[model samples]
Target: MNFREFASKNVHRNIKAYFAYFFSSSISAALLFSFTMIIFHPDFVKVDLPQYLIKALNVTTIIAYLFLFFFVFYSVSVFLKSRYKEFGILYIIGASRKQIQRMISIENIIISSVSAIVGIIVGIVFSKILLAASGKLLGFNALGFYMPVKAMIITFVAFVMIGIVISIFCSFIIKEDMVLKLLKGTKKPKAEPKASSILVIICITLLTVGYYLSITSSTKTLTNRIIPVTLMVVVATYLLFSQLSVFTIKLLKKNRNLYMKKTTVLWVSNLLYKIKDNTRMFFLITITSTIALTSIGSVYAYWRDKEDQINRDFPQAFFLSDIYDNKSKVDSKAGFIEDSLINQGIEYNKINEELKFVIPDGGKDNVVIIKEDIYKKLISMLSLNANFSKEDESLISNHKVKNIVLDNVEIEVVLKSDRGLIPTFYGEVYVVKNDIYEKITGVRGYFGAFNVENYQDTLNICNDYYNNFGYEKEDKYHNNLLKSRILRSTKVAYGVILFSAIFIGLIFFVTTGSFLYNKCYMDVIEDKKKYRQLNKIGLTYKEIKRVLNIEIGVLFLLPYIIAVIHFFFAISSLRYAFKLEIKVAAFRVIVIMLIAQIIYFLIIKKRYLLEIKKSLI
Candidate 1:
């Protein structure tokens, strides 16, 4: 047969082995194309996406591209490893290394090329649905889908280049192995796997430290602690998979009854080899899954808390301020704003408070005291009930109040607002009885809040007004402007992040499942002869299935179970950092992961049993 025919036939013969890799490559390409298409879509490009968000999208796409390259390279390397005996035979039959290289290259080129085309086709077919879903996620109703030729071209070229690089790299790697080594397909024998006691202790210590730091560190310290904590957790994960798992198996083996139970001996004996060989794969899967889960979950949590965040950041629709040299000027400006809103057919609620900065009788610090009536008006507007029996006072300050002892001015704090109306002020604000408030006279100021109907629409007009006539040091807290800008930018950024995360997360999850499938198939290949002997020795098909179930179930659940643990701690750390309740998001992430795991388990179980059944026949 010609070289092309030989290569094509080989691929067709090993279609089962190649299916998962091909499927993943196709999915990777499709996801890449879908994201790139967003960048190139006519409608998307025309919209006013924030510069930061644009850069973020570009960065995310580039990262996904890099990830795909490595993913494809790794998959190809693994595929070639399984074909070592085939390569060895060709060499024995006088096929030159160069010829073998050409075959490998051709095979990869054909598979990747076909998968790439299929991926692009799939991406095109689903682009509209993806775009609409993304639109809903970002709260942008105007997003529409269109096929972008530019995106297709970019994705095609990129994957083709990746395939070529992978082929070349594989060719070099395959040429290094000797014919005998390739033919035997055997690895060097090693001492039995054992866990070190000291290493075990270290593993526990590191994991403990990582989890503690993650959970307890305040938001301010979280950034500083991330590097050290992450390093600890990574090292711990590696050690846990490598040493701790083997050690646990050894400990379990010590219990004679448990070790000798039905199929337990068979599966346990095999598990040592499985864990020893697959430690790195399990570690990789766990870490990557942890990252994906945390990224998607945390971003969703942030999006879910957007309203509270905005209200905390910008509490009022407008903060009109001026020196109280003349109440008339303040009134005139306030009136102008009111008249402007009226002329434009906008409804508004106004809160005018004349403020005086005063030094209390025994206190050295300056405090702003608002009139009782004004405070009552503000409190009523917020729909909160407060009773002031002459001496009852409320303090509005971001700082925590402990007994309110400032230079012997011992006023009990009846109520405290941690995040007060003003964003910038650090000093104390007292809403006191009119009698006490009038007792002190100092520098005075005027504060007016104009809360318009349809805050977002009025915000645009306010911005225009400010640009045309606002003054410096005169603070304007446009709630709608600040809130809308923050929400839009945040939603766009986090929405894109969450989307990419979920996409890549699924890819990683499926890749891990495929890894498990491949491992199980390889085990079946090795165990078939043993199974034939066992069949003669009275091992039934049912017994064989029971063994396979335990073996495959353990293999499948190990990485995922560990990943769920990692996700729990990671999400907990984020809760402390964001200081937002994230139970709902965390629960959703867990449910989705569980569902995905169950589906993957069913597929793997079905295929693994089929393989076992084949061995019996």
Candidate 2:
């Protein structure tokens, strides 16, 4: 047979071994292609995405491409390692090193080309669905699909280049002196896997410290400590698998009772070697899955709680603010707003207050002072309660300030409230009795807070009022309608972010599963031989199946369990940081990911058992 035919036949013969890698590569290509199509779509520009969002999309697309390169390279390296014996036999049969390289290059080319083409085809088929989903997430009505020639070309070229680059790199992996070791394969006895006691202690300490930091940190300190905590946990996780796991397995083996239990000896004996060999793989899977879970959970939580957050920040349907000197202008704008609400058949309560902006004694910042009557009226409208006994005693509406001294008139701050009576644009605000308010002298401003029924349904009227009066280069009047618009846009931005994160996170998740499957399948031949011997020793197929279940379950679930633990800590930290009630959203994401992992595990387990069962026949 010619060289091309031989290489093609090799691929066809080992299709089972190559399937996972090929499938993963195709998925990577498809995802990248889909992202590219979205980026280059005509409707994307029409949506007027924020500049940061556009930049984020570009950055994520680049990151995905880089990840694809590394994934392809890693898979190819593992494939070559698994075929070391095959390559060693070829060498004995007089196949030159140059000829083998050529064979590998040909095989990779075929795989890459087919994978790229198939991926593009899949991408094209799913383009409409992808576009529709993206549109809905971005708050656009439709992102019509057109011929994605550019996307196809880019994805095709990118994967093809990845294949070529990885194939060339694979040449260096097959070193000249490795032939002897390759031929020896599992025949060579391996020394007992060792772990450093000091490293194990460090790993435990790091994990403890990391978890403690994440769990105990308050919202104020979380940002400052998040990086250090993350680094600690990540390093600890790697050590946990690489050192702690091996060390623990050794300790377990020392317990004769546990180690010698029914079938425990079989799986336990194999597990030590497997864990030692797959330490890095387990680490990679844990870290990647942790990242995926955390990202999706955080984004999902934020998206779910966005509306409540908006309501907390903006309690009223409309707020009109103007300088004290522009009293007439403020009244005119307020009248126009009230008129617009009436025209829209909306019922509303208007609380008009004169606010005094004063700097406290020895303080550079301005504090807004409002009369007790106005404060009570505004709070009552919003269904909130507060009491003031004396004029000297003041309630600070702003959470940050404790007390205020204006013109040497000291006012005792009695209560701090989370609910802002006014838009946060006015820095610090205090509610005092009329007697105290009259004494404070500074720039006076007109502030109006309007509470309306079903404020969300008033966007049209709010827009109209804003366009007529508030929309100007030098317009000093500000309204809550603008805040609502901002909140809407913010939701869209977050939706885009959430969608992107989920896409990237799923890719990471799927890649990790494929990596595990590849690793498991690579060991099948050795497992077959080992199990064959066990079978001859009167180990029934049922017993063997039970042993395989334990082994494979550990291989699949260990990293996932570790990742889930990491995700719990991560979600906890997120809850503290944002102070949002996001447990429901986070729980939903975790359950979804858990279900997906279980499904993936079942599919892989079934396939693996079939492969092993082939040995019995």
Candidate 3:
């Protein structure tokens, strides 16, 4: 056959090889495109977002893509290995090495092209769905809508360039096969875990220390040591897998019941065989699982850090400030009118007050409003760690308390504020004050939240407050406050869910994909047992089918259950590592994660079972 004819024939006859190669290339192409689109987006130029955010995202995307690049490349190698025997047969059939190489090259190229087309289509759908979801999450249904054309073009160009180059590389690599090597195939040495016990010990020790370091991480010292401990943790996890799989399997086997129960005996036996016989697959699965978990943990931590910021920084639910240079047409006293509609149990603290304005002659920086002697005690309460002298201390004790205002602002700016001090009056320990304080204060804004009767009431009140917010004439102190709070909370929820889902996806990608590749690889080595023999001796094809289902089900479930438990301990370790002192809201987050995991598990399980059925046939 000519090269084209050979490729078409080979691709049709060995459809699995074609598929493996295609999917590998497709994922690589999609990733490259995703990175290119996210990093070089033109719309970022027009958006009113920060430059640092774009730069950060660019760096993050590059790092992520690099990881994915290696991921795709490794998967490609697996596909190549799976085709070893077929290539060997082609070489033995009086085909010159040059002719064989030409045929193989074209086959790979075709496979890549087919896979890339499918991946691009899938990626576009994913991107569009993400955009719609993000828009809803952000509560501005109009904003951040994805235009796929630009992204598609960027992804297409990126993947095509990379795919073409990688295709050539794969073709060239395949040419290294001698007929004998293909016939026997490349045999990896079984894992010698007993011989590597010392290395395993070191890896385990290092991992333990790394975990300890993370757990003991002080929030105060978190800035300096985060990188080293995290890196060590990652390295140790992979190393542990490399050096300890044999040791672990042996330990598990010691439990006779575990090794003997129903399908458990078969699973354990098979797993041991897998770990020893398929060292490369074992390594890939471990590496992929660790990466998936770590990525989720890291991203969730980044997002959860915001919780501390929000809970500590903002003391008020409603903060309405005076907008500059605008005359009020409506009575600002409309708040009191609104208050009258509520029952006695509802406490409406209407705080209408303006602080004396103090600024350096030119309005260059944040203008600090100078507080009156009357307001000094109130100011101290807003900023934590605020200490006033003995004179101010006496004033606090002697000053009468009719109302308390929870003035929440940008914490740092609040501390360094440099407004002129309002003029002092002698010993005027005033009793009750009226609306005069509100006018003099310019009613810059109200800073208060409702202490509602119940939790649902709290949500209703907060939502109402969030909705009523608008720019007032004298209000300019901290408008970024609203967006900051909303974004912080939204990002926490988003990052956790997003990271978990992506991690699970990666696990499926690495794991189920690895299992498929392994089966293909073994089919070459295992053909000595004829398909006819496999059907003999009480083992029907249907029995093989049932066994395949059980094996796959075990393969997916065992690691997953372990992963969830490990993740809990892992996050608990996170709190200890960061020294973030609080009882974690773990139950709620876990519930959400479990729900998502169940959905993802079912989808992947269904697809995997379908794929397994195909692999068997």
Q: Highest TM-score, which number?
A: 2
What's the lDDT of the predicted structure labeled candidate 1?
0.74
lDDT of 1 by residue, 232-285 (tens): 999999999888888889988999999999888988887887887888888988
TM-score of each: 0.86, 0.91, 0.62
**Which segments of candidate 1 are over 4 A away from where they belong?**
187-190, 320-346, 352-377, 387-394, 402-415, 423-448, 452-485
Q: For candidate 2, lDDT tens digit of each residue in 147-256?
A: 98998999889888887888899978786567898797646678888999999999999999999888787868998988999999899998998899899998999999
Candidate 3, superposed: residue stretches over 4 Å from native: 20-45, 94-98, 123-128, 137-147, 175-177, 186-195, 252-267, 277-280, 297-308, 314-376, 379-570, 577-617
Q: Pick the candidate with the highest lDDT.
A: 2
- Across 1-617, the per-residue lDDT of candidate 3 in tens digits comes to 66688677877887654454455456655654444443334543444344555555555555555554555556556666767777788777776767755775666556655655766676666765644443443233422445557667655555455445555566665654466778876664555345277867877887677667656665455566667765665566555555576678778888997777655665566566554554555445544554455455545554555545344334333333333332132223235323532643454333334443322233333232323433453443333333333322212222222222223221111122221111111111221122333333322322222222222234443444445644333433423223233444555355434433453444345334545444443443453243336555454556555554565554444444434443544555556654443234444444554565455455544554455444445
TM-score, candidate 3, is: 0.62
Segments of candidate 2 deviating more than 4 angstroms: 92-96, 186-188, 320-336, 356-368, 389-392, 398-411, 424-428, 438-445, 462-481
Clashes of 2: 0
Q: What's the lDDT for all of these models?
A: 0.74, 0.82, 0.47
Candidate 2 CA-lDDT value: 0.82
